[model samples]
Target: MNKHETYAWFRVVFIGTACAWLCWRLFFADATGGADIWDRNRETMSIVSYAFVFAMAVFTRPGKGVVADERDRAISAFAAKSALVALSLVVLVSATIIGTEGHADLLTARSNGWFEHYLFACVMFGWWVESAICVFHHWRDRR
Candidate 1:
């Protein structure tokens, strides 16, 4: 298939695998004896997922003579801008919530481990949003 289709499929696979892994770790895995599998294996799972996605990306090849043109560049720029704006909004809202609800100083909020987890989640969400937008653009343009 074409590069755009391949990239979209890669994103799909990445997201699907990530969600499946999360579900398995959080729900399906035995949590007996108060052992938190997610807490203990978070880094390892993330590394494996990232490696798998990167391998998929590295192995995928574009169709012969396929090259990105002005339209593709425009779509990519648009997707990036959208992702940035969404991420900015997420950070702003999160900061506001922590500052108001937690009754803590901004510095404390920034430094809190819980806040860091939220930020990490937001970053991942932003990436998925960007990928979805790019995939949508590709699909729409193909139609």
Candidate 2:
């Protein structure tokens, strides 16, 4: 496979693994009524996941021959646009949920923690979608 395809697949697998691990750590670790998951390891998990992604990104440079041509640029632009649209929708829905709720302290640090988590999930999902789209376009173009 070419460098683009390899990088795309690597991103999908890596990010998917991290997300799965985090979900397990957050939701399934204490199913028997132990300490609250969010209160215990949420911060640590977030930091570790972010660091892993950053390290992978910094280390995984595309091969020297994988230059962006017109088609590649177009595909990237399309993926970026699609991701932005998805992210905007997520933001709108999240804002609506937060605004329509009658809780007066929704904006408070303690109360907004979940909202922050949701936003982070949305951003990660957007990034994954963009990468997946780029991969799909590259594969389809080759075929």
Candidate 3:
């Protein structure tokens, strides 16, 4: 596999693992100091996650002999556009649900506490989608 494909897989796996861990901490695990603790430090958690992702992107260089060709750039642009579309759809749906008070089951947050966290999670999911798309195209290219 090429560096791009490797990096894309890394991102998808990392984000999936991080999200799963967060979900476990939120619902199943009896985290120290309670789950409400994360509510108080949501911003910090978000910042840390964003920083980690950015750091990974920065550090994941193309290596000494690797070079980005037109196809790579095209794939990246397409993936980015697809991810943005996914994000916009998510935001729109979320806003509609929130605005209309349409679905009680959908809003499981305690006192609407999880809305901000939900948006952050959606953004991360969007990133994951982008990486997944990149990986898919790369694999398709191989086949």
Candidate 4:
């Protein structure tokens, strides 16, 4: 197989392992299932994924020419616009849920508590996934 396929396989395996590890850590280790569920392991996995992405780029392109054609650019632009719309909707939904559940205090650090952390974690995860998708597409374009 080619380098891209190899990298893709590794990424799939790594993400599977990370998810398994996360489940084990969150559910088994921290029975409370709060902010602590997203402990050091999640952070490490994020870093590792990003680092591998960068490394993958090194083998993905020819000398510094503009990689994407106009079609690729247009597609990416549409994808980004859709992603932003989805993000806005997610934020709105989260806000609505928080409001319906209780007071705004549940979303504030000084007043709320672990729920705020949990909410923030969900937002960050969504953002990270979107960013990863964009990066992956761009990498494919370059390749």
| TM-score of every candidate | 0.65, 0.69, 0.76, 0.47
List model 4 lDDT by residue over 93-139, tens digit each: 86787677475543442223334434444444444444455556656
* C-alpha positional error of residue 28 in candidate 4 after TM-score superposition, expressed in Å: 12
Worst 10-residue stretch by lDDT in candidate 4? 109-118
Off by over 4 Å in 2: 20-36, 59-63, 101-112
Q: Name model 4 segments beyond 4 Å from true.
A: 1-36, 52-66, 102-143
Which residue pairs collide in model 3, if any? none
lDDT of 2 by residue, 5-114 (tens): 67777777876666566545433554413235344655875787679778766756555665667887798899999989988987898678668657445344332334
RMSD of 1: 5.5
Which tens-of-lDDT digit does each residue in 13-68 have in candidate 1? Answer: 67656655554543355542232433455577568657866765676544456567
Regions of model 3 farther than 4 Å from truth: 23-35, 40-44, 102-113
Candidates ranked by TM-score: 3, 2, 1, 4
Q: Whose TM-score is higher: candidate 2's or candidate 4's?
A: 2
Worst 10 residues of 3 by lDDT: 105-114
Steric clashes per prediction: 0, 0, 0, 0
- The collision pairs in model 1 are none
Query: What TM-score would candidate 4 get against the native?
Result: 0.47
lDDT digits (tens) for residues 1-143 of candidate 3: 87788888888898877766665655475543343676776878768887987878676765655667788889989999999999999889877876775566545434333555556778877888898999999999888
**Which of candidates 2 and 3 reaches a greater TM-score?**
3
